[model samples]
Target: MRAQSGHDPFDLQFEADDDFGPSSDADWRPAGPAPSERREPVEDYSPAPRRRAEAFDDLDAPRPAGSVGDNPVHDMIASAEAAFGDHALPRITIHAFIERPRTGDMIEHAARDRRMERTSVTVRDGGLSAALLAYQNQPTPPLLVVECCAAAPELLAQLDQLAEVCDPGSKVVVLGAANDIALYRELMRRGVSEYLVPPLKPLQFVRSVSNLYADPSAPFLGRQIAFCGAKGGVGVSAIAHNIAYAISEGLGANAVLVDLDLPFGTAGLDFNQDPLQGVADALGEPDRLDPVLMDRMMARCGEKLSLFAAPASLDDDYNIPPEAFEEVTQKVRAAAPFVILDLPHVWTAWKRRILLSSDDLVIVATPDLASLRNTKNLVDLVRRARPNDTPPRLVLNQVGVPGRPEIAAKDFGEALGLIPALVVPFEPKLFGQAANNGQMLAELAPKAKTTEALAQLAQQISRREAPVAQKSSLLAGLLRRK
Candidate 1:
């Protein structure tokens, strides 16, 4: 029967046995016990010892705010100013695990700060436990923030678990409900970077983060002051060059004037220089720029002032990218104590970026209807873009042009919600002579009101004063022995 069906004889035997039932129960025993669940070893939960030694050693020390002459306090204030100035935060990743909604909102708002524009920020819920769980197998970021709602002992224990997962060199800031000094000291001893009690403001949080990364030993970066016009002929370039000269000559500080108006810049012409290579060259090859190359590219306008003149040529297209401009400006600022950027009236991405990033901005506008509207728009953009910074300084240029209908300086300032820093009247002969001679207002007429005003503006922006000239005394000359 099996041969006719073309089936195996073993299959036929098995079918016959199934019909008769199993003779023994040994063939159907259950499988072995399921494999035990895998888990990380408990021994790996110990706090990292390497970072404990690197914690702030002066956590318990009393920080005294001394008088004006105190060097320590002055140093501290200067450091804070540098951190809050035009210098942007370094590139780093931040992960914030916030449990309280209030703190979470503040952290989110702080992430939107201009200084944090280049930083990577991530906010998540569940606080320390979530951080502990998430970073068990993965690496922690450069900065880690967590909110703990527990008491001192429990918080310290949880922090131990958190420290185990944190990679070496990672900074940890804890947000807690307690304001106890003992708790703060203990946490610092255990390698906590900072411990803050809640009710935090966004700016305060930004300051804290900035202080952590500020390097006191780092080289100084110059402050940039950008000048732009509301219209094409508002004298922005001339003002910028004069300010640069004043800062260098009057205030006795090294300053560099960079002409960003590639096609129609007047910095070279105003300073009476014809450079071989200038700002255009630096922008063309930003990657190759360094202090040495920058030195070679600049023309020495004065003993303390350097000029990065523009090509002022229309023969070639100036299609440099926005990032290149930023990179070149950064390099230029590094070489001096103060930098003046002469921006053209044309609007572009690079121009906007430079204006917003400048430590100080000056807008030169004529007292005309068109200038009023354009100035209003520019002020609004600056306010919206730089919420943390002060408003742009306004310079009322050519205030009294005879027979030309003009808005009063007071009225213009009222409309813009800003007072005019300097109101320069229409002095055609003085300006014309200075331009023709390639001399600043101060050089042509030292005692002129306009020259004094320009000098005062320079002093105000640079936060410095010119050395008082000693009056020539006949008695002093007689007193000197031969």
Candidate 2:
């Protein structure tokens, strides 16, 4: 296989010295990394703890997992890879005192990766405490790699103190000798970004922490297809929901269904049971969104299937500002392995934004003049607007009305110079019965022709095309023109 013109690949040389912590090692002549000091040594630094029992009881809780939207992990990796690529580089600031061998090797390992530019500063008396203070006062870098080796009790006490002053925004990877799960759980709960058992593997250390910014997921290796329709009676939501379910059940781990319609939207209703809360509540507070929150939000439909739904709430408006989506969607990406967004027809700013930003967009439509006119306008507008997005995936729904004349699927496809991805039949009984029963078509009528067609559509979307198209849809055109 040949490399893409602008792409390059490289390997890392890692060192497993995490006990003491990370450093640059420029000044001192190097010997093999220092052996982790004996943990059994007696503790000299001891003071009656200031913050008492209730503090430990109420302590560091994990960020709740977010609603598993689609393939959020892949989404995050692709985003990080694109946002902070190899050449763009991320600077890691390492502050450790004395010749901390374990921490020094970890920093050395970080330096080996293409993405990191690691720098170290050694302060004598400051030790872990001083390092924490200096880091607090200075502007935080993207990644902060620190090493502290105090007895279990003293190290934890100092970390508690360090947590008070450390920059919350900077990712902090802690290195310590005690391999206690209680301490590990406590550190993670307390917001120590990631905990490492000492004597960290060189490759594992560099790769693990560096992975925070790497795009390493299956979907990122392929395209993500999302479906939405023009208006309520347009059959768009039904099409979007069905296609996603089919993709999940039929296509395995290759597809996911997301119901972004918060208020009156139908994914939850379509599946039939109210989740305690959904994407609306999750996005309401992006800073706190994580794996734990996502797990709670997801309602599993199958082994490989999950749904990110709108709260079936009518009391509040679904309308929100545009920038809210950037993070909200990012959180969703971390949950699902395959993301299919079931966008509602309403053309608000963020709705248009999500449509335009999708890797693949499918506009589900009826074969009528209004649908054709709107679809064509949407095609033209999305192509022009994105200028960097894949062409919208064209889908013609309910092609032949029983008695009414409608445009031919080929003609509809030809007028737009794009083929209809799928042309679903007008089966009110089939669609209605399934919806009323809160069942997916695959389960309702596994052998149904509609189910087979949707399943095929999912297959095509997963095709791993290189240099993916970047285009906007008529959805965005509609937003701008309005």
Candidate 3:
């Protein structure tokens, strides 16, 4: 596991495409002659209108009519979802040299974005000249942003000089006051990542940086939803497993459920699986766990669902460090579209890290005094730790247990300032039968209310809608009856 501490951000390697760097053509310096000998007029370029059929010609050849890529609207929606999804920016440093205070302020605000939490950003007021001076003796960062107000020729000359000090593989983005397409193209030819005109929004700057590192060929990172109990015996594991199964089986999405409770996890028994290698093995050697190795360690529970079962043994000590868990989970997310983490009812540094970093968190608690206190504590910690994110969802489970004095769900929620997402009554028969039969609630009773609630929870966390059932017409119903 690589620790975020004790490392230089500039030394971090960015996974950029080979063509991302400047071209090797000798004429790549600039168009025409040297800046001192000749000057070219900058012309305003505007795109010509195209016929409806020709509009999409520049895009990839059309896919099958029913495929997602065939519809431009669907493609845009998918791109947005992937961009704002549960992925974080890679650990790298960005240095911005801006001559205007507004640009520097925008970049500073963009640096505080949640996706940029892992990145380090420094904003200076010196523009391109300052960058040239700074990087002359030191190494350039992975990404650099410089603002220049010069025209095409002067800007090109300055960039040509700046290129001498820039290290290989370092990407540069230019911010200027001009909107000339010719300048944009010339910058592209010179290996600049992007050129933006002024009046930039903070989110726009963040998205530009995000797009630079976006790989069209890389696997999509999955959304991770972690489930943990407010106290022991709150049935957190069962809820997590059911939701994961619902996401895969009901919503038709691929999902992976990881049991992080290495010593006493019940995922194997719940799914009736016995894999020799599981999460413990991956955590022990995170650097060696690639996609091929991950497939070998996972237990296939269904057509669309997989399980990373824990060893669940007491033969050896399981004093694994927190970094190992982080590294293993990061690898697992790339293998599926949705990941469910069934966290044990214990507090540690690793548990806190997972809770804070998860895309969505579900805290399950029974209706009681002790549960109330602990749930409030957890909620407060999450609220403070993740101010930019949505608050952790609260689930009041086993609300109406017989012969036990329990607090009302409304009162419990009022105390914590969070409304319960779902209030499930005490139903021992259904849960027990499902457990005894080694099946999920949906498998045992598909029409049950609790099963439906779990399915809804799955949809909520995954940000995906289940297929809607169409209503039959009256004529069709009559024909069928006849």
Candidate 4:
């Protein structure tokens, strides 16, 4: 694919052969199926006339072969492509420096195809030095993507000098031949937005730059709170729904409730919304999900609350990648200030990532050995992984079930070294009525203790309250012994 204009941004090639990585001969190839492996022919590749123009729509379109499942890179690229559509190019400016001819061509193709409407993309030859010299007197664009054909030390040195000229708010991405983890870590520590090695997958390159411009510290971006159950029948879905409702109604925050238990999700029933279209629809075609599409998919539960009700179907098994979850939640999060993920009681890599990455976490568990064991493990994993964030809030639900021989709340807390933030008594009558009526607990019984507890939890999360303990207690030793 070629650039759209005569002065194509990615047309130039660098003259340096200094060394892109430790291994000088490491070849570059475009991402996805190798060239020799593509079986389909590019038959009649003209895109249908639309207001927006794309230089390489055919490349971004779904491969006739199938989906690019589970590739985080692919998902990120897809999201970037949508954001940088021809309509959004005018306000953004991108500067790309390429060392390899093929890499330049591939990047130029992607930039023209996915660039925001009216956005200017300037590609020049002469890797790092060219950029340094170019920006020595001129102002750097909002984004700068430069290539380096040097080893780690040289690359780092060049970047240090480049940093001197970069504007305070400008973001930088590095494209090099280096694949060393240590170098990657050091680059990250020194504040590099992203590093990519390439024959240049156009999508991946574009996505990396797009991510650099996504201000992670912005307050308007939604905060994801992953809610999971310690054991089955622990009412995690119910708790998640209530929390979302409290956030929306009581706290006056726009909230999105996503039910992820594809097979047995109760979000639809809990909210009294039919499952015509929702999370399944969004996940089915994640690449198509934008704010408008997401708004159409959500079922508005109240003034500020929307629900992405799961299909909860049993006819066919749902085999979606964890990346799908990341994709859907990411889009949905952008639509509201608070995103409550009703995660299913299943432990998987995707689930683990969601748990670890959430801005806040709530573990709904009952007082039992199984709940105790699972909750302990989950807390341990979270505490170790997210040492800086507050520990996951533990909610002891259904604490007083008659003749159930339950564990004591204090013992449960001591065992996990995490005191339950809220203890909800087993009130079957209240829950059953709310479930049957398709109303949130707070709506059905606003003055009830459970509703008050739910509200408190919401405040804690929204306000970023400190945890009682910074580290888990020694109860982990007892749990292991048991």
Among the numbered candidates, top lDDT falls to: 3
lDDT per residue (tens digit) for residues 305-384 in model 2: 77777886788865566777656675666555567888767777887767666666788888887888888788777755
Taken over the whole model, the C-alpha lDDT of each candidate is 0.75, 0.58, 0.76, 0.70
The whole-model C-alpha lDDT of candidate 4 against the native structure comes to 0.70
Off by over 4 Å in 3: 1-81, 84-91, 98-118, 126-140, 147-169, 174-191, 195-205, 215-220, 285-293, 368-373, 376-388, 402-419, 468-482
TM-score of each: 0.76, 0.52, 0.68, 0.54
**lDDT per residue, candidate 3, 216-318, as tens digits?**
7866778889998999999999899999999999998999999999999999999888999999999888899999999999999999999999999988688
lDDT for residue 246 in candidate 2, whole number 0-100: 63
**Highest TM-score against the true fold, candidate:** 1
The worst-scoring run of ten residues by lDDT in candidate 1 lies at 52-61
RMSD of each: 19.8, 20.5, 12.5, 18.8
Candidate 4, residues 116-146, lDDT tens digits: the string is 3246778788888899899888988877878
lDDT of 1 at 322: 97
Task: List candidate 1 stretches off by more than 4 Å.
Answer: 1-80, 83-85, 125-139, 148-151, 176-181, 197-201, 214-219, 468-476, 479-482
lDDT of 2 at 250: 67
lDDT of 1 by residue, 103-173 (tens): 66667666776778899999899998898899888988999999887655567767766755667778889
Stretches of candidate 4 above 4 Å error? 1-220, 464-482
Better structure of 2 and 4 per TM-score: 4
- Sum up the clashes in candidate 1: 0
